[model samples]
Target: MQHIIDMISNGTKMNESEHDELINEVSAELVELYEIEYDPDNLIPADDETANRILEAAFDLLEAVGVYSVDTKSVFTIPRDEIFRSVQNSQRYLNIGEGSDKYLLTLAGSSEKKKTSIMGGPNASPVTPEMFIPIHRSYAKYTDIDSIAPAYLDVPAGSAKKGPANLMKARQAVQLVKEACALEGRPDMCITTPPHIEDPVAAVSVANPRFMGSGDLQEIIPQQGLKVNYSELSRVYHYKMTGSNYLCSPMLVRGLSAATPEQFAIEIAAEALKSQVVYGASVFFKYPAHIHTGDPLKTLWASFAATQALSKNEICLQGSVVTSSAGPCTEMMFYETAVQTIGYVVCGCDILSGPVSNNGSITNQVSGLDAHFMAEVSRFASDLSLKDANYLCNELFSRYESKLNAPEIGKPFVDCYDMNTIEPTQEYWKLYETVIADIYYILQQKNRRISRR
Candidate 1:
């Protein structure tokens, strides 16, 4: 525990002043969160109490150093011994899915990647034993992702297929992991399976194992001494409700319905605490008129407030307008990325994921430039301290707040870039270069002022 503390607090040792400041800020924020108006009938007092306790522990650990990543919208801070002990004492493990030796190795390697901390694979697809080895090897070679999440296992809404066959898909996923282990020559991955236990057809049948059963996966995979990745638990939460729906409807709403941003955060933390898995919280920025009043600054502030209120865990607040609803243009894309990055930094998100455009649906060309631009800006902004980052984010938002409602989205991915070269078209690249230069200039000026101080 002391080792963990030292690892996290390497640069910024805690002083009395910093400790007091963190405690006061956290306490005040908790009070403010509790006072927010909500549908009273849906409130959960126990959840709120749990949230407060987590905050208290976080505050007491103020000596721990904290760092924010703009690319991921995630905040990484050291935990105090008491907090770690409390989490361990709570016995909060949620064994969701199956475990496999291969899957475990893939997960461990992915988790060690720099600047990337999450990996996800198709949950429904079944890979042949032949294909599984190559796929796992590809994953091992291509990306340095930290966690591998199960994707789309519960079959889409209109799929023609049915039933226990889904377990086959699960086995195939496990197979992919196993193949990867063979290629890597070392067993170092972590496997996590799904949580749903009750089979729909089984009114009372032991003959067929549940499709989403973690226990079944564990039983099948002969991997001993492997930890399961629990970060994917949120996927179950998403699957049971959202299924394959993409419009972000009541399904996503229900997941969030009962809790305030703060409360939801605590739930996320609790999940992380229980599983000891790397956890993430993300805020999807959709262009909702009522919430932001079409004011980008207000919208950014709202995002910041919500994300800040929920930064207890390894959370990432994704900031990007839904380009599908808004049309495409470079200026709107640039402004949105700038403001979003700023908000993410201020809110202390651990990882950040966009300058996303065309609603994250566009293909390479149109999307790549904005992604690259956003990534650069995010990287640049992350170099600043939280206070300065907040100031800049607020300033940018103030400048563009009036235009958020009708902000330009940008061209479709296929139409915007050259596929052969894997780069944006010349026109798009020129525009991106110009926008990036401008952002750098602004940041340079800010850096100068900070230096003078």
Candidate 2:
């Protein structure tokens, strides 16, 4: 810790620093992430040894770049040996939540565990306080969804009710979700996030200090990409102070920072490992691309390689079914979710389904049925092996990869789900049923292939 201070005192950046430094603020990540030291695109290695190489490479990148802290405008210049030791010392498994709702979280690819723990909710889509309760009910009612994440409050800066507090939304966020939990009779469902992790102190201020007693998950997101600000660090401190279960994943954009699919795997693998080492994350979430549903095959292969890198560590990783163009209700939305879900399941990783209805730029566009149908397909897909999974992924991607740009953003939640009853309407139910049945046929075909083999 002293060395970090000294390095910060001396300053890590040679140039005058910017306020928001994402992972590799310089835009050129020092590690190319090639295990074979060849082009990752054509010569990708599917073996455990390759994963090892990527892990080492990521560590080397961390060592060389030294993480930058935008809040302090300083670089964290720790020795590589010390960094590794810190990571090695972090706790591996975190048993979270109160009695009935407790979650046993492990590092990504931690073991040959069955049934990936479901953490379902809208992926922080914009939501009014009134709609929030019903939205959460949609997830809590599902048998498979074990945890719930709150939707982002449509609350804007200078909320009329809460005065000028930076965290007014945070407080409202906690209350809204808690209300929904009670309404659903699943008061114990572990909540990993409350809309945003941007303000850790404000985020934690709403908590009952006995977060340990309740066993809910609290997250800390390092600023930019892997860089830590005062806010992220404060959250980490609070997590330890409360003895709460911790989850962190410093995301990496595959297209922006990493030029190819293989680099995406290496960056995410390294980032996930960094979270474990740095944040003591029992499990971390890694996003494949900002392109969302744009490149299904590319994202799948990227997630596959990333999971392979973390598998050796027996770490648990949470992946998302992010969409580029597809939104709720449309067949495109269902198709994209299935392809992304298959990638994670076939790779043997858990899921954080649905932020499904938006391009990276669009907002306020997600719904319940996306997750409703996704969890069903994911459960069935989880039964397949990597070979069969990959074959299925290829077949599924062929359906929608071409239309990711101008996909039909389907109807809002109110239209498909009766806002009054919070149940799916007949039209939406049929849409979900059709997708599930289509996937079942695919699974049957997978079985036939296995028998033939």
Poorest 10 consecutive residues by lDDT, candidate 1: 245-254
Question: Candidate 1 has what TM-score?
Answer: 0.44
In candidate 2, stretches whose alpha carbon ends up further than 4 angstroms from where it belongs are: 1-7, 16-46, 108-111, 156-164, 210-213, 293-296, 315-324, 351-355, 359-364, 446-453
Candidate 2 minimal-lDDT segment of 10 residues: 35-44
Candidate 2, lDDT over the whole model: 0.62
For residue 263, model 1's alpha carbon misses the true position, in angstroms, by 6.8
Best by lDDT: 2
Every candidate's lDDT: 0.36, 0.62
Q: Please write out the lDDT profile of model 1 over residues 332-375, one tens digit for every residue.
A: 56765666655454444433432334343322213324444544
Predicted candidate 2 versus true structure: per-residue lDDT over 301-346, tens digit per residue: 6666666666556544555545546777777778877776765665
Off by over 4 Å in 1: 1-329, 345-348, 354-356, 360-366, 398-400, 445-453
In angstroms, how far off is 211's CA in candidate 1? 18
TM-scores, all models, native as reference: 0.44, 0.85
